[model samples]
Target: MKSSILTRPFYYLWTTQTTANAADVLYIMALTVLVLNRTDSLVSAALMPLMRSGAQMLSGLIAPLLMNRFKLPALLLLSQTGQCILFLCLALYLQLNDNNSSLVLVFTLVFIMSFLDGWTVPARNALVPRLVAHEQGLLKANGLISVSDQVVQFAGWGLSGLIVAFLGPGHTLLLTVILYGLAAVFTLGVKEPPDVESVRRHTAEDNSAAPSSKWHTLTEGWKMIWQMSRLRLLTFMDIIDMLGGSVWVGAFTLAFVQVALGKGEEWWGFINGAYFAGTVGGGLLVLTLARAIGNRYLAAMLIGMAGYGILTALYAINTRPIIALILVLLMGPFAELSIVNRRTLIQRSVAKETLPKVLSAQASLLNLVFCISLLVMASLAEWFGIVNLYLLAAGLTLLALGVGLIGRRTFHNAADPGAGD
Candidate 1:
């Protein structure tokens, strides 16, 4: 049965976000194949994720101030509309002479598209609390969205590959624009609270905090992070792990087909689809584990994530395509656990008034790490090869294990309502 709290806007947001995320994967894939075909340069190869990270960093830098006045829904809508325009331009370029074929142009388009996309995500994340009506509602709401996101990706990627296979990149880019337009329309179903509370909060936060000058507002999240040690630590750990994960993202499907198992591009789609499918199962287990054991979330996160790390390492070097695919599918069992615990920890630790800014800061920081990681990983992989990438990642995973030991206990006690008090 549908709860009234899970209203029409909620579903619309979920579906539209699904469409948005799916389109992003497709766009990346399209750009990847196009670049590979045009230049075959590994530096160019790394440009896609680097561009995304750069875009995200730019947004992350200014989000605290920008979000200070603009409510979440408006920010999200603006982002969606902005992406549509960026894609429309790219589509037109493709329809014109030689698709420009300039790596600079390609890099710029990805940066623009991704930059616009980053604006909305923090807003959407900030708005989650408003959508849900209670404490338990928080976990349930997050869990449902996680599950939906994974499910959407599982199917969306397969469909994206088919669209690319038959229609070609030009048509795929155009279709992405169309999907963004649809997302924009659906976004209209969302009603943002008029900028009252947001404005007041910003004023109060600024005035109460201290005298500040130039970009101080922009980097306020750093202040918040310093003040909140546990959060700072958690965000730092995420950055390190996310750096390792950058190669994981940049090369996963591509590696699965080309290097790991020697399957073709089409089989690569199957590999990603299976892994995302596992994430759906993973998200469900996250909810189950949280409910079954309240503060024991850390143990689940450690075991699940350590297991996921092992599986990813195996997938990196394994020769058997079937074995690799099966291992990846089973990866959800742990990935979900780690993610749910992370979110829960953040939610419990951060104040409601500052949640949006805090989230933005953390997201931006991780993404910055992601960009550097992508650059390093691509260079190293090109030089040292893919097998070594896994060995390096395994070492980072062990580092995360140490983090789990020290930080796990922190999150359990960090959520005291009176801590900041």
Candidate 2:
């Protein structure tokens, strides 16, 4: 028999999140194209991610303060509603302007929509364990969510071009607004679990530790990640991943597909689609073998980190399209496995109440690293070439793996409740 936990609220959460994910990708694609068409400047196109990342960094830093006041469901609803309104306004502005496509207005809307999105990411992640209810099932639940998220991205990005060509950017944005509205409505159906005592205990501890202050509250998540051992390790891994992840960004990947692969733009699209497909397959593998993996969360992460690095290194040297595509496809499962296990590890280690705070802090740190890496990677790419940049990314991942191996004993002890104490 199926668990009741997965039947109603969990089901609703999945549906709502998947729908929002699709809208998120669609609008991002639409806006990127819009920026290209309007400005015809690489710098303006680059600014798109910078604006969104900046908003995400700010939102993540402050989300914990809001989390203290609002429940996850309510926060999610607000995010969806906020994005819906922003998209509607942008669409209206475009329609009335007869598609003049003001760069300032477009970038501003992107920032706002992404800022709202920042809250939903951590809130939804923290809500997953609560919905699943069983610690042992967390890996399974995470795998399912990861699979759905990748699948949604694949479908959304795949169809986005066709949608924009037929309906135009304004109409495509209206479609996004509708999707956001549906997400908000579905979020209303989410039934949060009862209050966790650990949450209350931690809140009390924080209150007693420091006088009530906005700055203290805002920094609480950062303090928690730093003070907690398991969290610290995971956050470090996350930073490395973010730095390496920049290579997969639109700017870098597009350059690679053009220069290294020496293939048409269609190959660029195909390679991306293949990676997502591999990720989906990986998630399914995790779902089936999670039990067999047992408590070896650290091992799973190490293997993933190592596998991804090795594959990336191989990809950097190979000039053949078939070889590069295979490497890209093979990297997907390892990447997904690493991502899912590390997240599950955090969910298992952190107290239920504090998960959002930890996740938000982690998100903030990722954006900070990603933003910096973008600048660094771009500079390095320009100076050393794209293949060398890929090699550098692999080296960073392997560095993370080396750190993990050196700290292997620490992983075994990191999760102890008294370790932080």
- For every model shown, what is its TM-score relative to the native structure? 0.86, 0.94
- lDDT tens string, model 1, 133-156? 545555566677788788767776
Top-lDDT structure, candidate number? 2
Top candidate when judged by TM-score against the true structure: 2
Error of 1 at 206 (Å): 6.9
Regions more than 4 Å wrong, model 1: 1-8, 40-42, 98-103, 192-214, 250-270, 287-290, 293-296, 313-319, 382-385, 414-421
lDDT of 2 by residue, 22-106 (tens): 8988888788778777778888888988889989989998898888766788889999999999999998898888556577877
Model 2: how far residue 84 lies from native, Å? 0.4
